[model samples]
Target: MIKTENVSMRFGGLTAVSDLNIQISKNEIVGLIGPNGAGKTTAFNTITGVYKPTEGKVIFKGEDVTGAKPHKITERGIARTFQNIRLWKDMDVLENVLVACHLRMNVGVFAATLHLPGYRAKEKKSREFAMSLLDSVGLADLAHEPATSLPYGKQRRLEIVRALATEPSLLLLDEPAAGMNPQESLELMEFIGKIRDQYDLTILLIEHHMQVVMGVCSRMYVLDYGVTIAHGTPDEIRRNPKVIEAYLGVD
Candidate 1:
């Protein structure tokens, strides 16, 4: 559903991403893998409108969305979770997701402040939808609990749930398994697959955990020093010499 053509991002003399091209089909889970400083996140930022690529184009669903604002990108059906857990510490689980759901609500601030009938109706629907999302992710019981109060893994899942609240067709996850234990990582793999089918989403994932990427992604692109080194299936990537050297230096 999204593809980049020769997309590159430069900061003065530094080039964070160079000639990166990726194509992901609808409902596919694709992985972007690389070691530290690989510009994986930079690629994401460019795609999500955080930064306009200095060169090339970002096309989504047949539309050229280069340099579109992040909110505009969300409005066009793209949502993302950051590499770090970014829960609203003061908001409860339900409130956290409710914030994102507000994006789809079509009500004037004045009407919402006065609690007009139309505003109330939309608000009720938002609450119900938000609760249903929480329920689906098994977080309904803790809907009223502070977002930051949850355990680390649950917090990560909650972040994803919040992203889903935006009702996006494409979900970009940045290091969803960052701090998880092996068991949690394994569960995350299953969770990733579950959500892909459950939400009918096309996912672009940036993950350092090799197992998580290989286990869930049908195709992957490897990067080293902001340049793509290999692109292939998990098995093929595993056997590629360039990928091996990128991760484990050659003598």
Candidate 2:
């Protein structure tokens, strides 16, 4: 569903990602794993248009989408969640999700001002769909609560839910397990799989948590110092000397 060919991102004298190539097939979950400075998030930023790569192409569904604006990418069936939790603290959980759905809502200012039948209908449907998404993620009862009131794990889940509100065919999750406990991470692994199955999504994620990466990803790619070190199944990655050396600092 997504491919990056010879992609490189540079910042003045520094190269964050160099000649990176990754391929993700439909409905498969792929992992990008590496040490802290491995440029995983940089790769995501380039793919999502946050930073245009200095060289190479990002192709989505066979079309070159490199350098397209982030919203344009989202509109074209890609949605992403950041490594840090980003939410509307003042808004209710439902409201937060509703904001993303605005990209799909076709109501005009004139129709909204007149409360036209089509506008009202669409608004009602959007609400229903938003509630359904919250419910799917087990957040329905908190629909009226402020988004920031949720605990950390729920906040992470909510961020993912908000991304889903964009109705993406391909989902890019950046370090979804950043600050979770072991049990929470385990639940997150299950949650990721469940969402993939329920949403029929093709997933690509950058995760520092080896457990989550190995547990959820059908295939994995390892990077070191902004370069691809190894790519294979979890088992192969675990046994790879290069990956071990990168992570463990072994000779």
Candidate 3:
């Protein structure tokens, strides 16, 4: 569903990613794993157009979307959540998701302001869709509460829910297990599987938690200092000497 070819990102003199090539097929959950400073997030930024790559191309489906604006990429059916939870703290949970669904609405600003029939109908549908998403994640009871009022795990789940509201074909999750406890992380693994099947999504996630990656991803890539060191099935990655060196500081 997505491919990056020789993708590189440099911050002035510092090269954060170098000639990274990756391919993700439809309905696959692939993991990008590495030590801190490995440029996993930078690769994601390049793909999502947060920073135009210094070199190479990013292809989604069959289109070359290199350097496309993030919103344009999003509109083209890619959605992502950040490594750190980014929620509208002041907005209620349902409102937060409803805002994302507005990307699909087909109403003029004036018509929406005037509450025309089409606008009203679309608005009602958006609300129902958002609510159904929340309900699917067991957050329906908290729909009217402030987004920041939820516990840490729920807040993380809400971030994914908001991303889902965008109706994306591919979902990029940046460290979705970042701050979760063991139990929460385990639950997130199950949740990831559920959402992949439920949404028919192709998922690529950046995660530091080896257990989470091993448990959830069919294949994984290892990076160190912006270079692709190894990529294979979870068992292969586990036994790779380079991967051990990258994570364990073994000389």
Candidate 4:
């Protein structure tokens, strides 16, 4: 569903990702794994339009979406969550999702001001859809609670729900297990598979947790510095000489 050809991202003197090619298919979960400074997040950022690629092309479905604005990418059925949580801390969980759905809401400001029938109807439907999303993510009871009041795991799930509110065909999750405990990470890995099955989504995830990647991903790529060292099934990656060298310095 997504492909990148010779994609590269350079910052002044340093090339973070160099001549990388990646392809992800529909309803498949792919993991992007690497050591620190390996440029996994850099690639994710470039693909999501958080940063424009210095060279090459990014295509979603069949069209080249290279260098498109983030919102434009989101509108085209790609949504993402960051390595760090980006939520409306002051807002309720439902409100955070409502904010995401606002992107697709077709209500005019004037019509909303006067509560026109169409505007009200759209708002009600969006609310119902958002509630269903919240319930799906196991955040229904927390719908009225402030985002800051939720536990870290739920906060992470909320981020997923907000991204789902965009109605994405593909999801780019950057380090979803970064700060979680071992159990939390395991649960999240399982949850990733469950959510993908439930939503029938294609996910490209960047995760530092080895177990998380190997457990949930059907395939993975190992990056070193700015290049891909290996790309294969989890077992293949685990036995790869280059990947081992990159991660453990050829011990």
Q: Each candidate's lDDT (Cα)? A: 0.95, 0.94, 0.95, 0.92
Count clashing pairs, candidate 2.
0
Q: How do these models rank on TM-score, best leading? A: 3, 1, 2, 4
Q: Model 2, residue 227: what's the lDDT?
A: 93
TM-score of 2: 0.98
Can you write out model 4's per-residue Cα lDDT over 1-251, one digit (the tens) per residue? 99999999999999999988999999999999999999999999889888999999999999999999999999999999988899998899999999999888977889989999998898999999999999887899889999979998989999989999999999999999989999999999898899899898999999888877898999998888899889999999999989878777864
lDDT of 1: 0.95
Q: In model 1, which residue pairs have backbone atoms overlapping below 3 Å?
A: none
TM-score of each: 0.99, 0.98, 0.99, 0.98
Q: Which stretches of candidate 3 lie over 4 Å from their true place?
A: none
Q: On TM-score, who's better, 3 or 4? A: 3
Candidate 3 lDDT over 133-191, as tens digits, reads: 99999999999999999999999999999999999999999999998889999999899
Better of 2 and 3 by TM-score: 3
Question: Tell me, what's the RMSD of every candidate?
Answer: 0.7, 0.9, 0.6, 1.0
Which is the better candidate, 1 or 3, if ranked by lDDT?
3
Clashing pairs in model 2, backbone N/Cα/C closer than 3 A: none
